[model samples]
Target: MRTKETVPEEALFAHHQAAMEISVFGKSMDVLHKEDFLRNEEFCILVKLRYLLDNGIEEYAGINESIQLLKASIEAKDSFVIIDQTESRFRGGKQQQFYQFVEGLLTDFVSTEDFQDRLSQQLRETLTQIKTQEGQVALRNYTEQLQKLAERPLALKLLSLFKSYNLADYSLLRQISELVQQLSKKDVRDYQSLKPLIVANYRTFESLGKIISLPPQRSNPDTFMRMTQVLVLEYKYQLPFVQLANLLMVIKRWYQPYQNIIAVREQYPPHRYEQPPDFQTSIPGEAIFLKYKTWLTEKSTGVLFLDLGN
Candidate 1:
């Protein structure tokens, strides 16, 4: 969304909807753009968020994982939730006893006889994707053998929780990454505080692809990428899909009077979109979500949807 040259704040910004159109449906040099699919808002927010991320990357280097650790410590059950327009809950945890509504994903993945083999294969797969250049070297020095990965009592617990995706994967990966950084001098037990990586199954893994392709208004791109990356593997494993990612919130309060700049189009009369109440953002959700314990139950319901708690 960066312009070829810098654009000053006083400059007018025009997009598909706000800009002029020379309509000639599906013809050369004709402008017949579908309004629904246009991503001006996406591009705008992506650019803004990128600015925020670029400026604040250091603070959030481990934000996703860090938050999960805090969440899991207080909560006894799996910590997971799905963010969508419909607010659908993904089923996980004690199904069977967690719930008899459907088969229990946790019981099945953890109780299988060939779980060790599965863990070995999954470890190999996860290793290749590690962004760290020295991750493989660290694994080699730390893990003498791949077959015995899950044999470690903690490793077994970690892998079992990994299938569900939520609190486990981030905590496990971060702890493992930290362990590797420690040159394997510290064992996984040192980070046992990260027990029970909470997994929240929002509806089902089947909806993940749909969510990835057409994300909700507040979906985070990083979360989408992670889910998409996992979908490739889940096709075979069908493991419970849980995600630990961020959300987006655009907050523009009425700090100052609405500007007088107006946008004019040939099709419509001169109109202004740079005013309040008609803007892309609405009332801030962070305070509203966190304050209302009645709306958001204590530990059972998470109160973070505005990108690391607003």
Candidate 2:
């Protein structure tokens, strides 16, 4: 049995940093493309609640009372009640439950003022790094666009929340929650707006790839290449099945040129061809030559179609 290898702390930290950068870029793209400000509003509320709870604000207790009222309203439902009232009760119950859950999380995870301060500092440092990174011009531009969009009252609430809680951390969690909701909704039109962002992100990765090193025998390069290709296909085409089928077709075409070489080896068997070829003066000898060629025809045929300008 193969044992699991332990990663060095430095390598682990590097990996984490890379993943965090990618995540920031991805969330910025979502904010640019989705145009759903309600998510930001909800996030601001949650952060504010966390701040109030941490600081022992007296008004925060009113939220618990409000939740109790909502629960009572839900329980008071009767057949005589209109459908709209019942629906409102149901939504109220859900909202109360969500607030309670978030409150519990804040109490458990971010209980101390010192820890909250540290988290806020880390978030600020991370954002500053992202903004100042010389190679991340596109990401910087996207961040500017997000700031412009969030200039309204709802965004002002976000700023107020950030004054206490951590904006980057809260935004990351909010984006994750919203992404889950988006998946359930299956709205392709919103995703269509992400095409340019995806392409720009890919270009950013491509530039990073030039400076990164990998073992020559390892498959990491090909794996990352395929992942980028799939992202382009999924976002650009807006149809997963069609793009995936085309990807498989590309793999098949890549393997086609080597099939005859494999067939010849199988037919002759390895033992028969194990003898070294002899080159001598005045001797005519039988020789078998294996040649493999790959054509750009597959690429020309447009297996991966993308218009980055779009």
Candidate 3:
């Protein structure tokens, strides 16, 4: 809970105490290996130091002096705990290498931990917004949040996470797909160009379903949206069609005919209609008619269908 920017000095001192207590004995000095002991010390020290630096303790003097003090604290023997195979004559040559390694460790202690801390903070922040006690409801709420904000890039990123993880459910997939479609609205050309992203999100869901033994209901729109978002990210940015087909198959099987009728009607031109009033009574039957209708319409726009009559 102690963020780099907001951690109190007192709390960090407490963490120092806690890290010190991690040894078998309740003190930092009890550790037998000087380097290993310092390594443990370094964890808390680095965290607090970074916290201080983030909060305007910009003086390099204090931190640099602390580093020196830490280095001096290491026993000479512990600094050169090299393998027995090393020749005694080469000890002097190894000292320089040891110094370089220590310096690199110090630098790494500062930069890598700091980066990880920041990344953890960002992840927690984003996850907090999306996660909910209601589980499925929470996912739906998060998907709706992205939709409302029109945050296509963030949504895409989340979608990738969901899909690669196979977090797709019926509700989740529908919501994620809808969000992608929403992003494609006239104002957001960048989002329109993200069709591959949209497709990829769906594909991740499919892959996840195959690998992980999640409940089939996880593919519901709410669950699928979150899962697909995760999945889209997992496939190294490639969208898989097999998953998309599976998802479409699920949707086709489960979706109400009325809803499909509405979608088909919207796809058809206002002046044109399909042949035979009851042509779409069965699921596969409807799919075939719709596919043929789509192909013919593409070939001749509305003219071919209109000329044929209902």
Q: What is the C-alpha lDDT profile of model 2 across 1-310, one tens digit per residue?
A: 5443443455345434434443443343333332222234322233233334334354443233222222222222221122223223434333334323323333344323433443344334444444334423433332333233233323323323332343222323233223333433333323344444335444333322222221223223333332233233333334433433343243333333223323333443434333112111111110100110111112454322211111
Would you list the rank order by TM-score, best first?
2, 1, 3
TM-score of each: 0.18, 0.18, 0.15
lDDT of 1 by residue, 219-280 (tens): 34444333222222222222211110111121211111111122222222225223323233
Q: Which ten residues in a row have the lowest lDDT in candidate 3?
A: 76-85
Alpha carbon lDDT at 135, candidate 2: 22
- Compute the lDDT of residue 150 as modeled in candidate 3: 28
> How displaced is residue 116 in candidate 1, in Å?
23
All models: lDDT? 0.29, 0.31, 0.33
Candidate 2 residue 287 C-alpha distance from true site, Å: 26
Candidate 1 is scored at a TM of 0.18
Candidate 3 lDDT over 96-175, as tens digits, reads 34323322332233343453343334434444443344432433343333233222222223333333454433343344
Candidate 3: C-alpha lDDT: 0.33
**Which segments of candidate 1 are over 4 A away from where they belong?**
1-56, 77-310
What's the lDDT for residue 83 in model 1? 13
Q: List the residue pairs that clash in candidate 2.
A: none
Off by over 4 Å in 3: 1-171, 177-181, 187-194, 204-303, 307-310
Off by over 4 Å in 2: 1-97, 102-233, 245-261, 264-310
